[model samples]
Target: MNVPMLTTDFLDRGVELYDDVTGVIADDGTEYTYAEFGERVDRLSNALLDMGLEQGDKVALVSGNTHYFLETQFAVQQLGMVFVPINYRLIADEYEYILNDCDAKVVVADHAYADEIQPIRESVPADTFVGYGADRIEGDWHEYEDVLQSGAPESPERPDIAEDDDATINYTSGTTGDPKGVVRTHRTEHVHALILAHHMELVDDDTYLWTLPMFHCNGWGHTYAVTGLGATHVCQRAFDAADTFATIREHDVSYLCGAPTVINRLIEEYERNEPETTGDRPVRITTAGSPPPKAQIEQVEDQFGWKLIQIYGLTETAPLITTSNSNRRIAQTDRAADLKVRQGSATLSTQIRVVDEDGEDVPQDDETMGEVVVKGNQVMDRYLNKPEITHDAFNERVEGWFHTGDVATVDEDGMIQIKDRRKDIIITGGENVSSIEVEDTLYDHPDVQKAAVVGTPDDDLGEKVTAIVVEKDDADLTAAEIEQFARERMANYKIPRRIEFEDDLPETATGKVQKYEIREEYWEGESRRI
Candidate 1:
């Protein structure tokens, strides 16, 4: 009666029930049915086994969104080998640090990025280096296709994997110093997918566009969720507005996930092309990272006629704890635009609490800010080789609750609204200002496009509110005019004292504006970052 939950369960379900259905749409325009994809996974599994990779051994992969990365996920999980998915956007040094940190047994990288790995080839513990889908591979690099072809297509013997067996070691983009690997067991990964599938309404007929990077929290664990439900995966190697819209139209995509940056790009593209909706069916765009502005959300639904399911989480929580799905009642009323801006309620099987510094629950007034802590089966087991950090993550003040490091509020309706990250909150003249609040106001301006707000060191005010603005083409917006716009809408202390126009702002791979990067220049001589 007690069967084990496993990441491999997703693929097994698809193979048994939907073998004939198209499962994957590769970036190269190649298609594979569930049956065909299963066979490929089988081949890769056998090849890994044949090469002496056993359960618990780490297999590292570095690449963009590609079929090879997806296949490696299933194969590595099936054999009970730990999968280390490195962020491709990281530098060669960063990549080397991860490889050495994890002591990867085998390293698989895209051929295009082979140069990055070459410098630290000898230093990494990985014995075998596999390359996929590129010319001019190193002489020692094993071809990904060759390995798949070397083994028989028959399914390999399943390893004795349990629900709690080690699964993935995801490296977070380091904000402090070295990146730490967040370890998730098979159970966590499996349930995280199911929870996501439930909230996103993933069905067999739905097709998901791969706008989010596969490397990011395993595409927010949708890689397993969509695949398990037998939904078609329309993979795009990179996130491009033209290609994304085209993929949606071509594949009749019903669902997708992205951050605010991706949504903004699509909005820009949609305006230029005026592409038709994805038929009469509802398309869900699940956004995470920084919350979207109300105007942006309204424009997405009004102009593009697609639904937005905004979510919030981190790599530590298997990346999903809260989601704001489109509610018909709210959408029917004038409050729909306002609701779109909130992070919504706790997801199914997840417990969320907004607690003050003392670990006491914050009042549900939607104004009292506190840190968001979450508890659920989907939370990661631990940070690999990071006992101290893991211990600190589950702060003892609130036992069993994982501290999220985000400052937010809970409204009367149980909606969790994020004010800002704990570090991003700007303190000017002894008053705290939510960067998100100012950014939302900036988004309201007709001429402004993407915006980011950060605190700049000031002798008089301690720190002054600074704004970085990327304006719409041909729009002559000045710092004074922008400051004037904010003054009318918010407190004078909260309004940006300085504004700088730029072609674009620097963003992390997942679309989050890197405020720390922006602060480097301003705080160069200061001993303290704050």
Candidate 2:
């Protein structure tokens, strides 16, 4: 008999087998057993049901690495509702677009971020609003605790959810347009979580730290994998270098994931403060969002005595298709750091190929750059409401394969290393910023006539968003003023870090700005363009 896969299976197993175990530790030091966690999820499910949310309805959550974020995910999925986790860093307008785009019936936001949504609540489709800390929020919102108390602390009646039913809608930044909702089904998320758990080497006795944002692809699917494995989740509201170290010691955290920037920050903190690195247990960290430099990897493994794993993928691909955590590969080489820095070969059952413009596989000599394409169950079902774009994404370069739009080179051993991005998206500090979006904001400035945005290599952040602009005739504009203007319009991460005045931008015969040529000047001696 074939069994239908569902995301709720993770939490169900935790509740059944690990009822007495400490399942989650809230950011505020509140610990909940697996049974308590399951009941809370049930309460949330029943609460949403009482609020008129039916199966397939979308419930958007805007929060940091909090327990409620995890609870809401399992709670929503268990009842066959779809969960939409929004980036807490986004502005009200950006949230407005996502909340409307997903057609969320309910929105649950953390108090720290509820202000951003309160102003645009009327503009969104969500009829009900719940705040995690309602007392601190300046709006008429239902308190999360109150909402939970209003519903029964028992599992809500589940609908007949199929394996292909929509489970989550994660909004990813577009290359040249608005954010696209990457639709993931129950089967895709369930399989991805299982694959992630196996590759990350999660165990029942392990404690997972929440240094990474939970909203980021459901904490890169760790919310399920870690829970399903009966591991303890130590929540941290946000990633602070000092707090991360303290929490690891406090909770005996054995595993965590973060971007290269997080690794750099930890290194900086370690050098400055020399805090205790780990508890009795050895710690393992997985870095992605951008390749960690060799020095960072070495410092993490050698100095901190922690194993570092590098992974590669996008929001559209369940965010983990490849990982550089092969123990056998490292055993053969003295230069283990070198291998760890490269986004290694495909994970179990995931097929990855680097192809030239003609869709033919490129030579795996590690020097020839090609666009990376992939096919796997973890891949997203489609971009919500964007059929044409979704079709082109899978059909381009190679038919039936999702084009990653990432330029990479594969070594003889099939380890893929990313070199550049084919799309005009700047991934600065693990956040995607669209060059076109920033340019449009720059153009709104009366003094700005032409602007080109590019990603410049940074030692800390994998890439820094840089802007080159030509001011209007006789119009003087300072970089600070332009940055301030951008700050008011877009998210802080999307704001250009470095702005340069230019006489004119280089263009091709078709009058399209030659961004590749413009970016070459900034990445003069860098080994990689991204």
Candidate 3:
């Protein structure tokens, strides 16, 4: 079958179809109609072309969620240039590596992050580095507003991009180590947007709130789907529980995507004061980054009455390979609480399998442990400048499956139960301990807010299990008390041997607890990345 040819074609469609109604609502009370936003995109594209940007050249965008980011994304694609969205949460050096690695030709950044780019001015050898703000800086740079004013509104010829042509390069947050460039194509992104829209039940009536950062998987394909569905959009400059609740009520937001940390914070805020500002009905929230505990899931549904949908993916999978669809069985039974734990099956355009160490398919006995492998149209084309590693990722001890490096078990009911990341499992005294299990048990404690478990160095036990915890502000809890809490909930060996408490844990911008950062503190003075 021939693959469909699709570019940033939806932008043109949206501009022609719904040019009158409200399209984007920014945090600073800036609102634009669909026609006005489309014209801005065209002007931005013309400005980029006037500066002599070439086709297929990489343009890096380092900023948070904003309307400008969306315009720049479409603008670059209009000129047939590839867009590289850098995670703003990365350190200066990591940011430098990505800019250098991808050989970005131009960089457009917001003024708030000017200090972030100042540290490594000479690191990225881009042709132009423009900052978006009121003040002007000296060098080969121009103000964002000035560029739009200087150039005439000209439509550059869109390249005849094949389905395999590169469209964007999104870097993983480097939770494990060095970030890898997950290259996505227009076709992949288009398909991913469709899958997310269909699986999440997003429709024209849905009003989307941009909660997730656009730099991450292109806001997990919401930027495309929301526009394609002609859904109203509400933007937040940053995450604030009160602000989010108010936005939901103000704009009547029907759908949003966030990490479990976002949900946990919102849930905590609701529990603290029972938000009176919210609408009569609960909003829908889609959460990923990590498998949330059943207790948290229950809290979200019971207290807030919000529909919590669980999804699973990496940057390489367009960040949406599977989603927990409320099936007929789950809807009929009273086991909605139990169903929330499973990550559920693959979405419409994805396929997944659980296999043993020898690459054979594992039986869905709900007890047999195996690695989860996937193959789908949404899988990334390749990792930029890392052909060897990309080839290894695809040929991960299997014939044709792309190795996820995640271990899981699928029950006969087709629900996937994630055991652990292949590297996260700890074998202590020949007994395998899923770090997720320990963390799940810790999450049951009322005083514990966020918990992460990792294996620390040990001479006798080979590996020791440790739990790093963050406590609720008003709740006073000690390490011994937490140990007792875990002892009552889990098996003897699975209990954490050591407990560490902190005001806050290190996290990626997407709110994933950087477990490697947690483990690094315990393994200091060692030469290993772990």
The most accurate candidate by lDDT is: 1
Which candidate, 1 or 2, has the higher TM-score? 1
The true-versus-predicted C-alpha distance at residue 330 of model 3, in Å, is: 1.6
- Rank all candidate structures by their TM-score, best first, as comma-separated numbers: 1, 3, 2
Q: List runs of model 1 lying over 4 Å from the truth.
A: 175-177, 326-333
Worst 10 residues of 2 by lDDT: 506-515
Candidate 2 lDDT, tens digit per residue, 290-390? 55557677788899999998889888888899998999999999999878878898998799999998999999898777899999999999999999999
lDDT of 2 at 495: 93
* Model 3, span 1-530: residue lDDT tens: 88554557667766777788788887786998888888888888888888888889999988777888888888887677899999887678887899999999888887777567767778787867778873744344578878866666656677667777788999998888999999999888888888888888887767788888889988988888888777767878778887888888888787888898988888788877787534644577898888888888888877777788888998988888887776685786686867777788888868899888888878989888889899999889999999999888888778667888888889887778788899888878778899988988898898889999999887777778898899987898999999999888888999899998888888898998888887777789866433
Given candidate 1, what's the lDDT at residue 142?
Answer: 85
**Sequence-dependent TM-score of model 1:** 0.97
Q: Quote the lDDT for 78 in model 2.
A: 87
Residue 200, model 1, lDDT: 79
Q: What is the C-alpha RMSD of each candidate to the true structure, in Å?
A: 1.5, 10.7, 2.0
Model 1 agreement with the true structure over 328-417: per-residue lDDT tens digits: 637666867688788888899999999998899989998999999999999999988889878888985587789888999998878899
- Per-candidate total of colliding backbone pairs: 0, 0, 0
lDDT of each: 0.87, 0.87, 0.83
